[model samples]
Target: MSYWRWLWLALKMIYQLLCCSVSLILFCFNVFWLFCNLAIPWCTLTLLIVCIASKFVKLQRSPNEKRLLSLLSTPEDRPSYWAIANRAAGFDAPENSKAAIKKCLARGYRNVLLDAGLTSCGEIVLANPKRMNVAQQSLDELQKLNITEYHPMGSQYEPESMASLRQFAEFLDAEADQATVFLRLHDTSARMLDQLQKFMTTDEAFTQRTVVISRSPLAIYQLRKLKPEIICGLWHETFLSLAILKSSTLVTSIYGAILRNIIAPVIGISVVFLSKEEINLHIADLWRNVGVRPIVYMVNSPNEKRYFQKTMKIQYLTDSLRSEPHLLMKA
Candidate 1:
């Protein structure tokens, strides 16, 4: 199954590259025709210089990157994991619920990844904004609703309420001493940052152990600017999804690579969550050379887990702990 999946992905990538090459040829021809017709030699020469200059322009390290480098010098600060429980082991309980987190901890997983979004009252909750209108409802109103109703295994577990980011932090402080939490932010608004800043200020441990990740480069940049010491991560996959929708996969892949390699470093991200399809030794090494940890997501196969863990020596996010019970024993 894995081999077939890889083959399919390779074929898709080849087709995309062919399409992109054709588009680039047409675009270049059109631009050349315009340049010849208008006869603007100076404008063309100036544009060429700017493009060439951009290649050699060195990017200065941000304050956050410097701080991250220092922190990474310590062996204890380096992230090592068997797997991160995606959505707090959602298969065991409702995703982003307190029950899911408790179950994940009980299963001996040390790394947990949760989605975060803001409520109507400016409170951060562990929920996906895209799935529901989390921003339109107050925290109180959201908590009253049964989060498990829409879940496939809702009847198997007791009714669960939406878990707040504060509650997750407090739970970590009390129950899980060695655990690390990764918060994937769905709402990257100023209000959400303010709340996160407040939490990080009050809890020193949380600030050190928690990694805040976002798909938006601007959001990550703003976060680093606001709190240079806080651990931040950039999430990739949105651009690839958009590329598929727009039928411009190769062009988008090039843009995504630039964003991941160039823009993410400039934003001072400490970690990067890449889609499973994007996992490759070259890209992983690229991130490692620059002091950024690369993690793959939605990995569920046990064989793939062993490859990523033993061979790649990288962490991954998995949806179900039940699928890999033996790995939990090693963790």
Candidate 2:
């Protein structure tokens, strides 16, 4: 054969091979997608059934609680009202602000949960989830804004600027030596996690005292991958209205169940922070069975506080430490 003819044939053969390969890949992908569509509903239904059944089946505490408690240095006979400050006592001061954290420390609250996200300049700052533009602003811009105005009792408190995570760590170091900071991650980007990893690596004590929680399972999974020693928790709510899914209590509950039963274990989470409304003997027992500590949040009512502390025998997140006089007395 002529050289040009052979070259043309060779190019044609390569092109044909490429076309076939692409076709096979597309075919496999479609098959996989079809399988997922067929299987996911049945899987979800089965998980829902299991979740409902879990309510009736109560199990004793798994041996894993001892190890987790030891890691956290929590006492066996912890106070019934042992509460984590939600957004650093948000009711007293601007949520996720230095003032709020200071208020928490003053009220004898050592465990404070604050929202954290990365800024446009890549600095990690304490931010409110409601602020959609937080990630778009730099640290200086964020610090200039008066976050107190967004608070419910904004007019009552002085204007407060947004605080960075470094500032928070320094404040804790200087003021509350025994404080444990729970950072609920709002930014789940790789850069954010990398910066956090660096921060944790620099301060061994900070890493030891810090607990990272997130509503995103992927964030928790990635965080655990980055720093295996850091304690992580899955923040779950029974009903979160998502635009993608029809906002129904049942759908949300099933989604939460899938995360709790499947994703949480795979990610090696030590704790699960469930919303107060979802707290039940069966669900709490299910968590205990897997050695994961279950905590309820936004628990402010006296009756609810007593129920969780006395009846459930679990810790919780409370907005106002001042309102819980019984807790103050215990302190």
Candidate 3:
């Protein structure tokens, strides 16, 4: 072999090495830049939004046309709050059960937050319980409430049972004024999307109403690729421990809210499930950003719901109206 041939090979190897090194350095810098500039200051911004901005903007609502139950719901069909209720009147109804889901629909809730997640069998099912948290909760519910517990974490909790993904879809097909279902994904959306593709191809309304909300950015990203037409949301939140106490509610809500706001454009997230704190300021920031959607869960009271509607001027996720649902309109 010629010396020139060997030299040519050596140069090619050196060039390849140079390219790889540059790429690695660029990747590291990008990550560092995002962490320093975006992640850290977001909490501080939440404090500002909640403390400073919220004080000025008033929630100007009129006399009659305010409360949800009072609002002449049929024509509007799809309202803001999505009930996270169950069957057995949501008291003992299992999460994502046929009875519980049907009851929520029967009562005219157009949006529902159903716990649709992956189970041990690799099949999509309902019931959100930590294997760790389930046993204790089960014992408490069965003992105090005198009702059988549903959503027992593992078999040990009590013969663990969950509705299959297919059952959930079929039930939706049978329901009237079909709801916008929020599916909480525990794993990769890729697998679920594959399972859903058959339904999506044939059912138009099913595709339109379902929204996949996930904590995994990759899952949400993959979901978008599979069904771009379907609505999707990213569940984002990284919080400080002291952010909870109500004295700091203003600080935490605003701080977490701002961090969430900044995160939207960078990752192309529009709909989001923010942490349950910072109620007032979070809504305002998300509301002001015309394109971004803010959401929450488990609010079930007349006065509390009224406060959210009139003051925060935001929608929430609820479990049960509990009483005559229409009474909310009276005030």
Candidate 4:
């Protein structure tokens, strides 16, 4: 099943890459939008915040990576699958809306994720604020991630309401007694991140309940400098690749030629949905050697959830927990 899905993802990515340029061009174009978005507001930030010095940040100091692989070595590593509600429980409501996220939490998913998009003005809104007269795929120049809901062909597009970062923070404070929220940073501006950081520091609950996932090296690095205790994961999306080759640490790992200690440290990763094919001990050992756990996405099927719960024994970042309501308590 994973093979077929990954194959389809490969084809879709190929189509997108050919239709749009994705390499460094993707990052460069986002920087262009960053400036445009920043310029939307009169001022960048309302408050002045001091950032910690880079030199003072704690670097990954474990002498060997084996010690950190402790999570992967034991059956007790995770008793219940630690699932992350991908995009706030998938089309249950518009992605990242309060309604959908609440549904996931009510269904017993303890972790939820949302894409954090910073607006041109100083506000941090959810990733997909609906735009007027916009063709969905073309919204991003490079079409990376392409997280959007498909409407009927020729259907008029209009956004009613989307959650703001502040609104999400408030919701998390209220709803997180039963769960945690993971914000995947989409915009890396210091001012934008400051909005998130300030909200996080409001009380002990904020920092304790919130986790961050980011692709930007500088941003995550800076996050470490600021809050060493926060759990941060490195997120990677390839509309393709096998587990051994496409991870964020691939270049540093050199196909396992180099020691994992030399690779950049990340607590976890977002990857394709794992199936029975991924249960090989040899393959698990290779990943264990690296010390990073896979946060599998696309666990929307009840059978798959049951399989993962019984066999995979790891974290799953899914969009269909509420859709498969019966699987929630049993799995």
Kindly list the per-residue Cα lDDT of model 1 for residues 85-195, writing each as its tens digit. 888887767887767777776765667788998989988888966678999999999889898886788898798778787887787778775566788998888888888
Q: Report, for every candidate in turn, its global Cα lDDT versus the true structure.
A: 0.75, 0.76, 0.53, 0.54
Q: Write the per-residue lDDT of candidate 3 for residues 60-95, one digit (tens) a residue.
A: 111122222232123455333433332223443444
Residue 231 displacement (Å), model 3:
1.0
lDDT of 1: 0.75
How well does candidate 3 match the true structure, expressed as C-alpha RMSD?
15.7
Q: Which portions of model 1 show Cα errors greater than 4 Å? A: 1-80, 155-158, 241-257, 325-331
Worst 10 residues of 4 by lDDT: 46-55
Better of 1 and 4 by TM-score: 1
- Give per-candidate clash totals: 0, 0, 6, 2
What TM-score would each prediction reach against the true structure? 0.72, 0.70, 0.57, 0.57
Q: What is the per-residue lDDT of model 4 for residues 1-331, given as tens digits with 9 covering 90 to 100?
A: 9999999999999998876665668889899898778854523242111112222433553323343233223233223335667777755655766666666656655567877776555666666434321212232331233223342211232333555666666777776555566778877778766776766667556666556777665676676555554556655444225654555565434533322222234322212123333334454455556555555566677676766566766566676565453555566
- lDDT preference between candidates 3 and 4, better one: 4
The C-alpha local distance difference test score for the whole of candidate 3 amounts to 0.53
**Alpha-carbon error at 265 in model 1, in Å?**
2.2
Q: Return the lDDT, model 1, position 317.
A: 88
Highest TM-score model number: 1
